[model samples]
Target: MKSNNEKNPGISRRTFLYSLGALALSGCDGGISAPVTPGSRATSRVSTSGITLAHVANGAADVATSGAFAHPGLLHTQADFDRMAQKVAAQASPWYDCWNVLIANSHARLSWSPRPQVEVDRGGSGAQNYPVLYGDIAAAYASALRWKITGDTAYADKAVQIMNAWSSTLQILGGDSNVDLAAGIYGYEFANAGEIMRGYSGWAAADFAAFQTMMRDIFYPINVDFLNRHNNTDITHYWANWDLCNMASIMAIGVLCDDHTLFDQAVNYYIDGAGNGAIAQAVYYMHPGYLGQWQETGRDQGHNTLGIALGGAICEMAWNQGIDLYGYDNNRFLAGAEYVAKSNLVQADGTYLTVPYVSYTNVDVTQPGFSTASQGTIRPCWALVYNHYVNRKGLAAPWSTKFALAIQPEGGGGNYGTASGGFDQLGYGTLTCTRDAVTPATAPSGLTAFPSAGQVVLSWWGVAGGTSYNVKRASSSGGSYTTVASGIADPLTYTDNPSAGTWYYVVSAQTATGESSNSAEVVAVTALQLHTYLTFDEASGTSAADATGNGHTGTLIGGATRAAGHSRNAVSLDGSSGYVSLPGNVVADISDFTIAAWVFWNGGNAWARIFDFGAGTGRYLFLTPKSSSGLMRFAITTNGGHGERAINGNVALPTGQWAHVAVTLSGTTATLYLNGNVIGGSTDMVFAPWRVGPAAQNWIGRSQYSGDPYFHGSIDDFRIYRGAMSTDQITALVQGS
Candidate 1:
């Protein structure tokens, strides 16, 4: 809390919105229920948004899509197939080499037969019979690939036969908790195979219907259920792979069946779901050089590598559907992939390289250090990721590039190993995902601007040759431009503290040789964003002074005391009654706004607010880490809990740790962020400060309900922006960049 004015320097205005979004919080308060102690890996699930169509659409299916979904769009699109066919037709070096490997895989042979199971079980008394499912999944995909690449009807017939056998025979996925694993992993694989072969006319219309019925009936429920409740255990009890595999399956099925609802579920989950598979949780932390430490990095390399495999498949599927999950969060996925690749790939001497790691703790395990178990476990994941970021998009991934090349002509399912892990990815990435390298930055695009109380933030897309970016400003509409800032690196975000007036902004890519053309211009209507900031650095003070010029000093109440903080002294609170009361109407008038803070909590009582502002219990806007309905929530309400509209930050707050949490409202959408990353929130929040009237009970670390517990923790570096803060600005607030 020393001074957060220096935080988020790197946040420049950029395009906005990724999935971490709002779902409705149903049911009003349950009459002051007893406070539940949320331990490690606590549940962050807000609520299920929608049930998949799998529950109802279990009959004979139609042969056509809604025309919105692309055929063969799961992991391998038609374009990818065409590319492979072309490369192999010309006897291309790597493609041909990969083709050789595919032909040699026993699962791809015409003589291969499907071992149908009435019920496929992964755990419990069934003796781990999931192998039949995985092996058949592999054969189906390989046969489909042979059909697509070689135009062989025999392979198509074989693929159809394998698919029909399973569709007609498999009834239920049975087992213990591990059934979820089988549902997710093989579900995606089977759906991918069917997606490719769906266009084959040899696959009878009724036969395809049965296959669709099987997927929707047998797989989607398990996939959606695990994602919704995580076996009704702690949200973090299951690992990232568990979530990712399910997400992958759901997405593949959505594409294969053209069910937009199912498809959106997977996409939304990947973007903002509260589970470990979400982008923010999967790549949990970012180090310097944007090296994101993957969620399972400390668990072990095998699972960590599997995380990459499934994660890459999800991203690629999204990309094939014209969604850019690969570039979300400024290539954060790339950062994670690079970190994992560098760690798992060995040097020439078979020595593992060290990478930066933060200790990871969930409900079940505490990994204080990186685990080398199964280190250097190579998978077919690297090529898809490396090609998308470095070759297709013209970004850089040094570690990923080396890893992809090392395992060039990657093999899928059957070639990696006999286990299910070997088939996690469809492999043959070089045959399907490889693309010629793109040209470097010709000019930057996607420029945007957001203005607040005293500053304007500007951001733009990255270009190939962009070693660094240069920010330009103009008093006029287009220019006579002035170079205000130069040499900004990747994830370009720039804030200019402009004098009060309309301002235009643009950016250009700078390389070793020269600067590129300026990007399209954006206009800022206001000057700055910061309205009120409290560093909470005062030594043993009863009042927290406002660092911003707009006065809104807070009065410490109920024995609120000083504690060691994120930077300096912070406001500490007792669970019984301690809080900080703020000036009336502090944020009761602002339409677009952002509230952010750094808090260290003891992980105690429920319904403890980080901040609450309202006239009374019936009408208030509050942000709490332990909402009765969720882990972290920000809500604006007029009729108490019954009429609350909130953004649920579907992520657990690390107890005994200083973490950043922020909520921003722009238009009707409110986004919640944790530790500078998007978690989840609401998109249709109607309750605003103006709607809530003048808030008289504005308090920090206290709830409006008299019976609710006060937050047991410390709060520091509180900030409020008059206008909606962009992602970069909020990130800057958290990262102090």
Candidate 2:
């Protein structure tokens, strides 16, 4: 194996060993080498035009070198590198365990299983190989970098042995021409070797160049050609493509080797196609494989994890090349990392749950067929290690720290229980946190009330730990309360604006941690009670049936047209027929209520009219032509109140079409019905109140003030309510109809 630290020509292994021993004897600091200042050649800015791209390359190098920054690595300090190395070191034992499973399974020919071919099994059972190599190479380089920083011979020797074994295998595999066989046997192994060597110093320029050439000239072309030839665009399953991992691995190597063309093409294809956004789109278009799978099972876990990881890698590559194809800020890789951390690592209990599938979908209801223990351990181990690296490099958020702490096993067996691959006693010894309780700092001594300017104001002491407050108000002593304002996190005061009524108000406090408790209810009142006024007949004594007063009433007569001089009388309160018309038009007060009435036709071909303007003021309520059915309508123009309903059962009125009709308005909702059944209803509306004046006049068997759809019917028993009447009330009114 090549030593990255030696000065080539004169530095022998013995001299190198002696120098390191001397440094160790001197008790020199061994954690991290001091970071070079900006002016230093090793740390100088690569290029201003493509700063983003340069930073990405630097990030890749940092990842490759166990987070070191002696030369190619940038955007991280010595402390950052040391922290990353420490995390990688801690995972060495676990990596060994997991990798041994792959090594055993691979040697046992499990990779050659025929039931599910290798390509299809790559994610399912064959996933072990790649993760193992990735872990090994990462651990090796990280350990070597640690030794470089600390003058530790043991670390250096171990790194060299690992590298020697890794490099020998790479050389043997690179010599093979059977591309499929080579990749199947050692594809991940090659990626791992290339990644580790990427962090090595340029002093071994010849060996590095040779290794780079082999990867580019042989491995890359063979794999790229194989992938392109076998491309299966029809497969909707994301991981089914053999090139997903291969493309990522090749891109990483190509970027490091400065193969610009390969790098560009890799980026274009992956980001524009197999990248993060692409996977999300695919998932949206194609529902999860298992029905309600997201709710029940963890089947989608592997795809989500792989897509996110690959997305992060591609983003890093694009960032390093100064190409923001995704249109986000220059920190595309960091964005991907944050997204993965938030979606996968963090849990509702404020602890990191290891199952990525659990975070992707609601799973408490649908347990996946796989062993819960496997789901828990595998996901958490992968996520925490990845997150630990991201956090140490300062690429993650503060919230990720909580996730890291949660996934660690309480007594050291691992975070998701005993790690025995069973769910019998899961979540035991886990650290979980819940929303904090809240308590008011001050209690109210007495409730205060005030009424002024048609609005009520109430004030109270501020409560501690409350992020929001809710206020409710009601009319009458024990009426139901209505919400005035909620989730208002402000000074402890509220105001109530109600229509014409005295009301009581109450408040509740809510906290940032989602805790809410009611505060003492307060009382308040407004000065004036506003009333709706109804205008009827103007007080005039007799028969002129004043054509210029605000109220008037009458009966309909004559067929098609009124008899020339046979005057019809307006019925009075005492039922007298002495031309007893009110002086003005009739107006009914219905602040929030239902109105019902009946009309009877006298011999007339014209439809009977119920509501009519004194003059032709463009407002009237009457039935259409008899051939057009006994349909009746009500129209008012004070504020544009309009409603219509018709009898549609084929029930004809005697001679002329005269029938019963009703219109109801209840809090923005209005209904129109004929006889008894409702025909149509309108929601979210306001029927303007009607007004009558002294100049208004009423007419019998004709429009009170105009021509055409005139009433040839007798009108009687018109009533109104001050509030909304129930269906039963309307039903009884219909019986009278």
Candidate 3:
């Protein structure tokens, strides 16, 4: 096993000395490594006494000395240590020292910029220098662990030097200065630094205690002050790219200090829209390479994974401290791990595949792809490691093992090889496993003889050693097909929900080696209508029974002459009845359905029922009448409830002139068109086939059940369709010459 200290060469004595000199020169103004006097104030100090540093150190030392272990603090037995040491010894080289350089540079920056008042871009524009405070803290702790394991005074001295620098320079600013100090609380940059420092405190109890006091008194309070002020506010714009970093850092610090106020505030910010509402929001707000931007770019999976991984790490740290992150519950994190493992990792059979992104067409399944050689191969490996801890600690889920297997690298060649150099040394290993030839299967036979309802089942044969399957469907021959379901390992079958119409299905099988072969195609039929149609006829009915009752059954009373009625109730062309009761009782069974009515009224009233079911539950299509315009109004009740749509102007009803009105419901959207022009539209909950009949009748002139106002206008021809008509279709119907 490679020891963290030994594997990272940047931690050499020379580098340590250089970092110390940098810290000393940066400012000895009671900032870096200044010994604390009894009366001196402390701020942003981190203590390590409570952490299990000894165990961590022993674990690290065990790996370094043995050289055969794979990870530090993971091996349970001495034998396991011996086995991992061999692997490390064979792979160890000077290049491993780069990690140390990173550590040193990171520490030096942390120590000098304890509270960075200004940004420093190290050679690049917009790139801020490492916030060395946390880096120094991490270095000190890592060095202390190294010292405990190897009894190396060099490591101990380095740790002491870093700690002393932090003790003196750590400043707790209040009042106006609090702003400057609080700016340093950028979470991503500082939380890891604090964790590192805290890790080191394990070596010396008194120093750790002092560090804890400094963190509690200085660092934590400033963070609390800033967060309290910005809580539930849109101040995310102020921090710009580092918003998540800042938020996560605050939460981590709050957890460290056990400050419920800050912690709860952060949690509410994330889960309750105070923080970035979704990962996408974070990505959208930041520039590329910024904390959120890296994930958003999507080109470099490694970098994107790092952002998510850091989030996971911080989540774990918070969880360990008893903080509840809203969306990142153990199950969700475990689910993410499962996704990465099953989709992205190279399997043991030498085939690499993973779900790199979510498919826009199908939000459920992750799109799979083979990894490129240029990217860092360690990402999935790291995810696996973190997931392992979560699983082993019983903190995540039992499915973690399954997820781990999905991402575990295949043991043979072409995999990530053990090497000891920089960039060039990171290429793929020798190819040991031969790539399998993939051939697309013929379209499935017996497609025309499928079921008409329930689950649409599709099946195929001939795929051997297959690990999973993907299913695609299209409406017409040679049309575009989309993946509807995936990741099925057995039974060689899939069942799709029945819809109204004929549909086609196709299946593809993926091998354990990551090769995929498409299967033959199949088609199924459904009873539900897939389209809606509409038309308006000026003459139809007058009273509740006449408007909804089939054609001749409707009452032809008074000025409700079909021609006169054309300006009001429109017409019910289909044999289906159109009924209107007082208060508003009306219903219609619509697959893809359209409602056209001519209404004429000029009055201000509440609960003006344009159309609704007698029961007043489930779906409702109604209108809200405004004092300004007797123009027109509409609403839809899908999913479970209802909402309204009202027109902008008050075009007085042309007394006797016929006017057209139509509402169309298709898929999950409902649109209201007046005289062929789109007036309003809204997204419905989901698509459901509604049933309308005598009890569930359609109201034409007034609302029957509840009283507010009744329609006083002519009636006309009303037509309903089995499908939703397009705007063009609706326009033609409303404007027929």
Candidate 4:
């Protein structure tokens, strides 16, 4: 963060900080990568022309609040328990043995007892009763998992009893500075145990509420304080594991207590917090072969391995609640996990293998090389992470898989040892994280088919042990299919020139054994040509050429000049006089249309049009990054602003980043989308584009209102489709098609 990103020149130090400094990851529940949600960040700066601009943030950051959280969403969710119960009941090998380990443990037995203290301290000069607290935490969590798997009231009663003892007796959790660790680590653990048992009828309503209160009152304060202040030291002084545990506690407790504020807080901190736990900071540097160097790699292997435990916990929690932090920052955590796993693994000859390393440093200290102290460290945290990427997402995780197998049939809390690190993560992956049964043998997965202006593009995650892929296509949903392409090897992708019709596609993997079954299906409809396509790739021209065969080429009017675009060259507008003028009546007659473009918002005045097509203010269809009401507005008016039909995004367009903005009109329903997620829509509209008559002043960046200011940033790949596309197609547009 202190230096420019020389590797990815697209993300300069300033631009990256501006883009992701305050943003959170946003996308569908299980997307390949987490895209951005425009945030409402405003900062003032003087422009080159001496204009003082209050630059608002655009794309490259946060999702809106979840509005709601799924119940029992923490380290484990309902689905994970269900999977465990089913596998164990069927006497499955790994899960059944894993269950045996759980039932055999003293903490999981009905004979377990609670040990609580009014003040538990971990540092010097105080009652060091924190171990007692960690012990009770283990008992409570183990009993809760047993109850979940067996549907036994006895285990639930025991879990509730342990929790009640802690909540009723614990009032003050104080220590020298290490209390933060006690608070963060046990705070998240206790909350997860409480979360698992929240649904138990044996645990009465009042007692459960008291447990919630204990987590909120007794634990949350320290967790938030540590994250916010970092023990009053340099922000980078604390290790990544410290910030991670606190983040996990905040996120888990938020879900347990049903608080979106806490949930968003943890998520925002993970993505944008100026701490060691943030993605870019946690995985500080990328090395060769997709390995990302963990921030604590130089400190010690014991602490370095703890990062995987905490990060996996955070990612799993977010994934269960319909977010994709697992793939956040293009899977930086996976890369770091691979690096850590390779560095800490044994190489069959009773010797630790050496791995690549990049010297990591911060304000507090510097480590010029990797540390060999406790080098062969192994943690039970690998299974959950390995299963997610390989079995769940069909991506390779070689070292992650190796380490998980090394620690197979993982038991929670007490199985590793008596140390605090053993209890730091909620283990038991052979039972909860194993997905070998349903792992596809023949089928490739994560199939995506995107319909573009003239063609359809297809891609998928590779099947394990597969050598090649066969791309199959059909005219209808359930084939009757034929091979469009076969024997695709590396870089698993395919493009097809289908005729003007709807097409269904799937991919099958060619394993050494044989050709496997087909993957999940995807569809594409390629009918309409790009009505008015603006490439804006003319680097030095005043004419913004139209790439569509149609002759709706645009002219760079005022002072608009060619600048760096989202994908290629773009048109840069100077906020006042700069704008693009297209031929008259560009989209004046289309009934169903889709308009999509990539925008770089420089925080201009309100009502600056990304595009406006109309003869006058009374009859126009325009999309504005920010409206007078401080929201992104897409309005179509035949009778003026007051009488216009409009759809507004939840927030204004963020400034200083490239955001994919799109609007689709299907029948009377006009929807507005940012990135890939739908932000707003209007369903009662009756007017169509033809109703606006012959639009004479079809313009980009200039609004219909004479008083409105011109757009202040850049626009690229502006396109108009003759028909409104589906959500999947809009998502494809987000992928830069």
Candidate 5:
């Protein structure tokens, strides 16, 4: 029988060996060789307008040759493991065991299977797995990693075989519900494996070319389309994970295909994309001493940690390409990483603290430490983040370091215990991120201050090596800076009681070394005024009273009953049988006004009005559901106009989940906000102004038109201000609730 090299003619054994030798020689000081730079034959095919592919190609060469930068460089090429194996009979590190676990699994799974059919399954709680897709990617990546680490021909051949199978088969991504996720999570790993093995001497040029076509044809489009659509103009709002995964996928594929535009697209979203992907949307600023809130922190720890891991993966890949995404946005990702670590890890003693989490129905619950968040599962996620934020950047992440140390001898994630579709980013960090290093503390940067409803909010950039921050405030700029807050953790934002005069603020970094110099001063002045406020904490059978001094009291009609609301008490409305009648003239005098309410909608798949203010059609201002989609639509028929001016919310008012929905109509334009994020808006409209019907017809949860829809959700703390509330005020309200 002929050898594998003899069977392939595109690349000879001699050429491959020479390339490997050159790769080994090029890893001097962990930088790429001069020939590998832009316009070189090695990266001529890929665009390099804003990003360079040299780092990726160099990492591959290093893996192929000296294996110096081989510690999880898309593919592992470290020869130290082989050296350790030669020196000791026992495995040198715990990572070796996990690596062996993958090798053993890949060794057992020698056959490759792929399907040519397309699947577009959508609209289920869980996603549809297509042709055992992610499983196949896992196997292929494991085989590729094993091949690079161990120099095993069989593993390399198996990985190539799997790639060949998928290239020739598999038509479409599996489902609709989480297609972006499938494309992102699976596409990233798949592309990584493909990128590594494309250099194999025995892999035929035709086969490699065909696989490239497969990636472009199948995976690339799915990610691009989902990312372009953003929210797809719907109420089924895409979470941060969806956007993060797609960003990861597009970026990985872009690197694989040498497409700079694609790479830039993903990075752009990471910086400024709206709703998701952007750091602002993913992180929540909190008071002193508390870790910044992860987007999924209130949801669960499994997702929270996974998000960190995946986001860290994107940053790691970018870091290899010479982009400092890890350190971007004042090291916000580090804050999220530490938050998850501190929330989930056991303390020095046996006892651990519980992290407070807010549920979907607006209920606050404390999650037990280390075990109960995300169903008490430990996802092998600490290594990458630890390596980047602590190991590489020399930042102080005590809790993250502790958690990574605790999950020692870290293993792959599949079936490790209970988690399924578990990612396998294990062991590499333990081998790579451990180093003796120290960094001096620096002053925090970008100190900023803004006034919100009833408070002055101050935020500043986080220092790289800081564990906590100190915020000082005073009424004057030159002197008398009192220590109003100290030891503020990551996401250095603080909310203080509003005083009548201007407030001056400055923040400093606190690390193991000491407190750094103070940041530039920032100032804020109280600007927001509440016109009307209703807590809806009325007696069971009485009227809903306005907390705002301006009397806009509402009479409970049709037996609307009092119950638990957003924070305090609420009033429940029956779609057909209940509604609240407010004084008609309460909102009649204001031209630019704001209406905000905390709603727990139970009106399933129907048009239901939350607020209606006129006696006939085309004569009222109303907020209602846009049919079965469950999205809220705010309409204003200016003084019985000919056409209704309205803007529909992009986010759905999900059933059973208490959501804060607010609409601000400034001049003729209307903007809708959900949970403090801008969802949608209408630009132009012509109407007379604000007006309401006689007393009986002006209602909450009921409309005056004969066939108008009545709301079936619980309403709490309904407020109508004389002027449109500023975005900052809306944000503060959502945070306070």
Candidate 6:
């Protein structure tokens, strides 16, 4: 009976949607409309949406059976498994190897031995031999998939017999402290078997109903309560994988029962409620100058990769329901995959690159500087992450892609690592998800940067399979560099105006698959006066106090909160309405000026502002997004009024990921640089001396327009200079010089 707003902040936004279940079940005398046909697509998937058995069952019946179907349905449909089997039969490259391992291990499971009165009891310690029951569930589902693919009714009959025995005889499921774990992991697999078999015309309707009853009674409650309350722990208290598994369980049950409310609950929890369920919070941002860091970065790669796999399973279920969790939050999940893959990589020198090892309680688990460790345990976990990021998103995932390739010929879970005992059988990806062929773009080599009086020119050797190039720079060779330019196609050279300092640069190729590795390092130097800088390092409070000691502080407005930055703390602006207001006249009188900052944008159709400073009607300088394209647009009204000459970048700023943006004005010219390369500018521009209203009208994440132009993004390391910066100086600034 709790209203959505009445619940604690810990409660998620999806609560309101799911809470309408009661009203939905009881159709109003004069209702808006009947629930949209389940199998047919709805105009919109709002709270009022409803799905039927036909909708959830469509996956199992689809003529061209594919993976990533609705819940309750098997992970791979009939056609999907058939293709895998065909590949196995032909002794294909990767599929046959995985199939060989699976067939070898699953020979004994061909016969069904259903334990109807199975009671897996873990002592109070929450550890037990429940894998036996879960193992049976895995076997049943695997057998059912084989039956559908091969048209072997014996496999189908065995799968049916297994479900029938459990439904007719199983009376109770308890005795384990971690009984919820059993319900979550085992229950979903069982439900999926029932879902696939439900499509079999031979399976008695009565028996299928009985199985559905069993799932609803024995598994649904446990899984739902666990996800909602986390075993009476804090809502966000459980381990990431535990929460993910339970979410998967609920989603499966929801699909099996044709309950859109329950399905929505799982989606909402993953996206909003469970803190660890979100990609941003679940995996910590990579430190500004370091590689991307996952929440479990300090943990072992086994557990970390397991988290990605389970989470992917949940998202896959959501995807079947027409949600795109895989692409959500700027594809934040990719960072975790890359982080784990990079950590587990074997270097040419035979050493492993790893982060510090920490325990579940955040305690250091290894000696100082010896925290780096690699399990080198391979499992069938790579496909889910790989198919989504590399194949679907078209983003580079070099480490993960390589790891997925190395683990090709993947077998069942018990063959390695913590996934022993039939936990994560993954032989399907090689057959179902593997690309026919992938020719990755080669990395650009021999990058060089030269500094001139007002410009820095960067050139690199081009390679094949590349549609464009990405330019990155850092102040020091060891510092983490930010992308200065992206989508620079052809002519392999770029020019920029920057301030003075030591600068390091690199170039990378980008193709349809992903980005290539950074080319060889190159350095450049320039001379420009360093000016006001604000790192926004404080983790809490309302002030973005200036780190440059120029005393130009910013006040956080509305609900602006601190968020992860390139290297430290930055302010996050709610897309609708939140920003940081700076004092007027802070840098008002400058004739020539350069401004730069690192930004992480959450895209919207609206014009999202980065920085806005100007009079409502007169001379103004503002940076905002252009509608449709959402590319970075910098404009200045030197003569006042609505007429404005703006430089709009050809390449849209990369959302979710951080990039450096700088704009400098010297004489009558204003040039904008993304990362460090010049993207857009004009030569025939009139100079406008700086001026501002006495009121604090200038802001980050908001504009001084009639309707608020609030930015839904994060900004950090903001710097402003009294004079225009040379191209090399801008490169140095972007490189953290």
Choose the strongest candidate by TM-score. Answer: 1
TM-score of candidate 4 against the unseen true structure: 0.58
lDDT of 1 by residue, 342-449 (tens): 898889998988988766666666677899988988888888887887778675566888888888876776585312245667787777778778875467654545
Per-residue lDDT tens digits of candidate 2, residues 4-108? 111222343223222322221221011001100011011111223222222222121111111111322111223434543443445543322332332232211
What is the per-residue lDDT of model 4 for residues 282-331, given as tens digits with 9 covering 90 to 100? 87654434477888888889888889988998888877776567766546
Please, what is the whole-model Cα lDDT of each candidate in the order they appear?
A: 0.73, 0.35, 0.36, 0.74, 0.58, 0.59
Listed in order, each prediction's TM-score against the native is 0.63, 0.34, 0.40, 0.58, 0.54, 0.53
All models, RMSD in angstroms: 14.4, 25.4, 20.1, 16.4, 18.3, 18.0
Between prediction 5 and prediction 6, the one with superior lDDT is: 6
For model 4, the superposed segments whose C-alpha errors exceed 4 Å read 1-61, 417-421, 437-462, 467-510, 513-737
Candidate 6, residues 1-737, lDDT tens digits: the string is 01111112222222322222212222111101011101111112233323322322221111111123453333544445566767767888776665556555552156647665645543344435566666667667667766765677887888888888888877556753366666766776677677778788778989988888888888888777766566564333444666666677777777777766667666655543433444433554422111335554454456566666666677666655555556443344655666677677667787776543322222112212222434554556677667655565444555677778766656552553223324643334565565443443357643445443345566554444467888887877745988888888644667755566666777788776878888767655454544567788897999888776767788899968998888778888887778887765444334457889999887765566788765343335777755446577887652233335567787788877888999887655788899899988876344333312112256788776666457888988888765577789899888863
Per-residue lDDT, model 4, residue 610, is 97
Estimate candidate 4's alpha-carbon lDDT, on a 0 to 1 scale.
Answer: 0.74
Q: Candidate 2 — which residues are off by over 4 angstroms?
A: 1-79, 82-139, 148-154, 168-203, 217-219, 222-244, 274-298, 316-402, 408-737
Pitting candidate 1 against candidate 3, the one with the higher TM-score is 1
User: If both were scored by lDDT, which would come out higher, candidate 3 or candidate 4?
Assistant: 4
Cα error of candidate 1 at position 471, Å: 11
Candidate 3 C-alpha lDDT tens digits along 360-434 = 111111222333433333432232333333322312222224433333331111122231221111111111101
Quick one: ranking by lDDT, best first? 4, 1, 6, 5, 3, 2
By lDDT, the best candidate is 4
Off by over 4 Å in 1: 1-67, 417-421, 443-737
**Residue 2 CA error for candidate 3 (Å)?**
36
Ranked by TM-score, the better of candidates 4 and 6 is 4
